[model samples]
Target chain A: MKKLSRNQTFMLITIPVLVLFFVFNTLPLIKGFMYSFTNFKGFGSYDMVGIRNYTDLFTDARVGKSYLFTFKFAVLATIVTNVIGLLLALGLNGKIRAKSALRGIYFVPRILGGLVVGYIFGYIFTYILPALGLGSSMLSSTKTAWIAIVIVAAWQAIAQTTLIYISGLQTVPADVYEAGAIDGATGWIQFKELTFPLIIPFFSINLVLSMKDFLMVFDQIMALTKGGPAQSTESISYLIYQNGITGGQFGFQSANAVIFFIVIVAISVFQLNFTSKKEEQL
Target chain B: MNKKNKVAATTNWPVTILLILGCLTVIFPLYMALVIALKKPSEMTNDIAGALSLPKSWSLENFSEAMRVTDFWHSLGYSIMITVVTVVLAILIHSLAGYAIGRCMAKSKFYKFSYLYIVSGMFVPFAILMMPLVKQTAQMGIDNWFGVILCYLVFYMPMNIMLYTGYLKNIPIALEEAATIDGATTWSTYWKVIFPIMKPMHATVAVLTALGTWNDVMTPLVIMSGTGANTLPLAQLTFQTQFGTNYNLAFASYLLALIPILIFYLVCQKQIINGVVNGAVK
Candidate 1:
């Protein structure tokens, strides 16, 4: 070990992650990517088809709907979760009784698996709520599926977002707010001038994280809707999975995945750059 | 001026209302679920809404039946195996790789390698490879609890490296350097000096990993669909069937899924708090 060269050291360390990545992810990813350019079912050798997979995927309405639904969910979840979460933080931040226990109660859902959540909430959505006259098919129908999914997504995410907001809120300059108060600044005005400006970074965190969350909303959809009453809840993750695994359209699925990959990477890069700029500007 | 003061006081109502609403929103679903879980099948279908209240007669029958039906003890053990092994292996490998990549290796290659693994890890969504990952793992004959553990490492390794590396950047190398000078080998120096020092990160990673693997359903569902390898998540997914109208057993099982995590979250609550507050938990 002492006699090992720098290159040797790199090999020693990088090899584990790299091997695991290659065997598990990178290789399959490449295989998937390559197959996307071909006509491979899960069976034998695949033909080297051209851009057909990409063309078909784009031309398909259901495929396009998945991305749109995913994007919409991400947007709504980010906004709702952050706004509510920030409000929760601001409320809880003040001298409150039993804050710790309240925090634990709020934080419980965050700790449980999403499948459990999906089941628990699925029971609520499909059964319990209906018993109380709330519509049961909210998740099943196209018109209200968006709101249902966003609500569920927000419910699962608010605790973490609340924590983030609390962290962000703690660093706000107390004196600036006091001065704003002296100037007869109202509650809304103080938040607009003080809280909003200083907490822009937290907002960015909330946005990007929600993006991640929305993109990966699979188990919930799978459990709750299975992409249906009429494909209302189709999402990118679920779509890729259907194409790749269930439908066995490996080539088309791979194309969808690669495109999905590019979209995600692009969004993440854009978010990072955009948020940093906001952080600087604010 | 007095009107303005009154207006300001009235406006704060939104915050107060939102605070109570947010807490209720967070807690009531779980509360509802718990209420259902404690009820009998007879109580469930008779009145779903009424079933959400405390049971007229609190019964441990649903729990015992849930335990028997889901084969709760076996799956619990398997869940423990999956969580413990994945958490240990993921942390150790990541910390080692993080330390070497950050300090021990040459700058040029290290930077490129770091970006290769960590950055790409962030961009590609897991759903893209989930299908193929399942197939590949099945092909490798690890489509069981062990497979679940390995899959977790692959799924979570990126996160571990990304987190530990970020934390390591904040850690000074002087301690490791001093240890090396005193004839401590690289491994021991890492174990004694570097590892312990990264305790916050360790605790964070452990809790995070445990939370993740314990809560995981998709990976297990995809890969380990075989008998004798079902996780608590898979059990919970089918909980609806076991007590379909009996919201009690369903929610009971959901709460059971939650018990381990709640214990985990409480035990490492401080460490988790430190991690969340310290920046990089996300």
Candidate 2:
């Protein structure tokens, strides 16, 4: 048999994967992009409405609210998770008893389904907290509902972030700390000058990831608030899922989705560029 | 040396106390879930303090009832099948594509373009594709398990391919060159040599994909909602309304959905943590 050329071999290996991606990934994106401009209601009998959907997004109160809520939730959740995760990682990395066991316990939340965790926390907010005389259920009020979501999000998310920080902490050689100690650097100063610079990459990784993940938050809202208390906690993704397909607002929500896509892409590019630049300076 | 030891000893108490508190917060929801799940509805009191106490007669009745109501076995099977199939296929196809791209991108323009095109999918939010994908899958008559699996393959492609390609970089090219010199075809070389060499990456990909697939609710909810099919997470959502105020049944069902993942995490937490860190940092 003739030996396959390198190009032939490459094509042979990659073509299948490429086709799969096109059919399931790229084609839908293109189709969605096209559908966004038209009045396609996710089924038969549709007319092209040009840029009406895009224009409507600006005027639509619900769309505006969803965007606002999503951004707020994402930023708050990212900050909360990262701060708690870093603190926990610092604590876990110390000379604590059952360090590995504690690490494992902290990570338990990461493995459970988001939907399940949401439900469990939903119960806690709805019944347990109220029963404990913590006032009314947080889920019952729009003001505090998002806080509940953020808490649950932080609880599940901190596990992985802490693990990442721990790994980052481990990468900081003990000699660095010993040197700092010799220089009479206290814990806070050592952390500020030595530890922080070394783990900036991991911190940035956690930041970008946490931001991205929280921006697309859906399952938790579904299981907990169902985007309720008058849809105050509705995220961009949840809005797309709830109103776009099910509510027969496909074209309109497709427009929302396109904008959502752009926002995510922009944030990711910005974060990556920003973090890489910071890393270089460090 | 004396100062360093004193500093360490002084800090230990605060760090340990903080970690203990963190551990409690992490375990709080799970503990509540377990306690509530084993109780009968009649045994549950109006007060949160009473809810915190162990059941008067720790019963598995809630589990049995939740199983019957949710058709637990069926959804469990679907979840298992979906996760296993997606993980297996993701590793195989992704690694192959990764190998081709990882090896050839520098020297070949098309391969380079393909690599960028595929990896760029990571930034596009799934919300953008959700509507069109639903329509696309329905049109192709694959709005079921096959479609869900196909979506998972593509959904994971960007990250998985990136991971595999990065892992592939550490593999020496001389090994493949030697295989070629020994009368080995690209196919045989890949299957016999490159594939085995990629086992560690394959494990990482498998764990990540399995966890994602198993825990995901959105994909199945969109693709298979009305088809009398459900993954565990989807099933939990569908029956959530029915569970209503029945915290016992709801918690039991949540625990049921959580158990498999919990077991997997407990057994391979170290690997899971390392795999997640590897995925994130790269």
| Residue ranges of candidate 1 with Cα displaced over 4 Å | A1-11, A44-46, A182-186, B1-21, B45-49, B104-106, B238-244, B277-282
lDDT for B53 in candidate 2 is: 87
Candidate 2, residue B146: Cα displacement in angstroms equals 0.9
Docking quality tier of model 1: acceptable
Per-residue C-alpha lDDT of model 2 across residues A222-282, encoded as one tens digit per residue: 9889899998999999999898988989999999999999999999999999999999997
A78 in model 2: Cα distance from truth in Å?
A: 0.7
Candidate 1: Cα lDDT at B263: 83
lDDT of 2 at B11: 45
lDDT of 1 by residue, A18-131 (tens): 777678778777767777898877667778889999999989898998888888888888889888788778776655556676666666667767777776677667766777
Model 1 lDDT, full chain set: 0.75
Q: Model 1 clash pairs? A: B36-B248, B37-B248, B37-B252
lDDT of 2 at A59: 99
Q: Candidate 1 lDDT, tens digit per residue, B170-244?
A: 778777678778876676677888888888788778877777788777788777876456788877765557665
Report fnat in order of the candidates.
Answer: 0.56, 0.83
